[model samples]
Target: MGIRLMALALIPMLPHLPFGQSSLSTSPLGIGTVKWGRTEGLKHAPFSLPDDATLHQLLDAAEAAGINVLDSAPAYGLAESRLGSLLASRPNRFHVFTKAGESFSHGASFWDFSESAIRRSVENSLRLLRTDRLDAVTLHCPRHDLSVLSQSDAPAVLSSLKSEGKILLSGFSVMSLDAGLLAVPHFDYLMVAWNPGFLEHQPVIEAAALARKGILLKKVLSSGSFTSVSPAESLRAARNLPGNPVILAGTINPHHLRDNIAALT
Candidate 1:
């Protein structure tokens, strides 16, 4: 299995992406805000929800640090709305990527891959995000097999939305490597859970890069647990693979944000 890693320096060669032409950060480190206004749900329950002022302050600090990419999802309560409100006030200041296909209700997760659901999801995101067109929308980590996702009409619906200029690209935040490999060729990008300790995604990550598909990465801190490892080690031996991934570091803590930024520059 031969692997050829692409350089992060090749981002300039990428075609004009839907992310508006703004003076955004060149670093692949992005701010992932899952705890903005969200709490009492998700993997770890009872997470603290920051006040609106604090949220605004965090965004200001992130942008001031040249981290302009944001990753959000409907499952993350208050994340989309809070980021939307802030980003609306400053258009093109951040490249916001959101998710569909999976949503939460009453602390339970639900999967909806129907064509109508996908359409509705995109529309809702556009409305909540306060953007005329979204930069990118992922499949929100569908747990079903590839056959189910492939059989669904959701992809066609997203493609239609893309043609209509409502969204720039369709992709997935994949949890299953099999699904990720099977699904990557059909979409514009895929965000895989990656960290120095997790090696399960290396093949799929490299494959996506080899296919010339865009890639985003999550779990930079192993889902917010950075104990047991040093930042320097993770930064060095962590991404020893082909191509560069925009690491979505979800942290409202300024110190963690600074450390995430250090992972790149």
Candidate 2:
């Protein structure tokens, strides 16, 4: 049976990423969990991590708004473990997307895309997330670009894990147009940055769409720096992009979540 997403609001599904390669009905707007844990290497003004109560409230608000996907990464500090504990009661209700190849330590980010490191990272993510399998696992390429896929064992490792049922999908996340385009034909889906001010990655989105691959967009708010444009308008513009990519918005406030959902609707 397909994993059904239970929500109080109606959530529209994007075109099947590659049309039946897998069975994942993704919501256009996903919740980003960076602020649920990590404190360093953030672009937004410094703020306190939400307490458990606040986090629970945020989750509730997200579910009510039909936001089913939660994007987390090891570099986000305690986000994975916290989500594991909080959602332990109903893990199947949401699609859990995470990353390998990047981690945080001493308030700094690190990279590891080797064969053994990628395998170990996938295992660790499974253990921490309290789920036997992850919905999607992407290479968290920050310092490197598409070359990382060829120079390292990340591709083969991710492919092996998918065969083993450790993850449902494998993809790439990067910050550059050339790299993003280079990665399009290499993975199942992609996570790229797009907004009104930053249109450098527009070609990447177009290419991914032509390939019929799934796409997840990050930095929709430009790290909370939307000056002239409102968040709602920005989200509306992203939805109209090629492939109808899923937009990941990182916000700790429930009110903001509602506003974002409103824009997408």
Candidate 3:
């Protein structure tokens, strides 16, 4: 896309939610940082983390392209810390969205949705991200059932954090519709998967939109499963979906970043 299209007008803004003294308004597209830190247990080809200079360039490109939201997680290896260091000198330029309830260690992933675990995770994220108040944080639900939220007090912990002003928006990320349905009432936003090849989460998206909650679409490119379709096509499909969800693209290449932004046009 041209520089003109790369302005803040490229993507439509989602409805704002009251967050303390200010409100939260996110772009229709966000840059996912899974590849920013870890490289194990991924479907993509083997790759290494970019150097500081390269990451700085990528952040520059993203900001110049009008992307103001970033998705990260504790399970994403050193993504949060690296991002924290990179963003330390440049604070409040982007809305940093992270997760709790999951962590990565010894080259394997682990899940813990207990109230204490969630609280500890959020606190660690705050220290690592170098921010006093998180723009948004959600429970990282790796399970396929509602037990992750229903059986545990993770959602309540997020609520408490929000009450204390430690975080602005709270939500959950799930892989199943049932879990998404359960999360709707508890979260101010949701991170769910949706792409052309998979539409199982359509009901969840519709329901969240109908409820007037923010929706973030993950795996929109199916983790590079867009063999038969272009990335733009997948993004366009997401834009047409309910809630005008923010499509999170996890591309590390600068060229691909621009291409993804162009796709939104």
Which scores higher on lDDT, 2 or 3? 2
Backbone clash count for every predicted candidate, in the order shown: 2, 0, 0
Candidate 2 on 1-265: residue-level lDDT in tens? Answer: 2233344334432332331144787778888999998988889889998898888877776776666788999889999999999898765778889999999999788898998899889999999999888889989997557567668889888999999999989999976777888888878898988999998888988898888888899998988987999999999999899886889999899778877887877
lDDT on C-alpha atoms for all candidate structures: 0.71, 0.83, 0.82
Please provide TM-scores, in order, for all candidate models, with all chains considered together: 0.85, 0.91, 0.91
Instruction: Order the candidate numbers by TM-score, best to worst.
Output: 2, 3, 1
Overall local distance difference test of candidate 2: 0.83
Q: Could you tell me which 10 consecutive residues in candidate 1 have the lowest summed lDDT?
A: 13-22
Best by lDDT: 2
Candidate 3, residues 112-165: lDDT per residue as tens digits? 888789888888999999988898997888755588776888888888999999
Candidate 1 achieves a global lDDT of 0.71
Reference-based TM-score, model 3: 0.91
Model 3 segments more than 4 A misplaced: 1-22
Model 2 misplacement above 4 A: 1-21
Model 2: per-residue Cα lDDT at residue 48: 93
lDDT of 3 at 261: 77
lDDT of 1 by residue, 1-265 (tens): 2121232222222112222122222346677888775675555435577777767766665665566678898888788988878776777877788988888878777888888888898899999999889988888865665754568787777789889999987877787888888877777777888787887977878888888677777886677566778764565454455555666767777666655555555
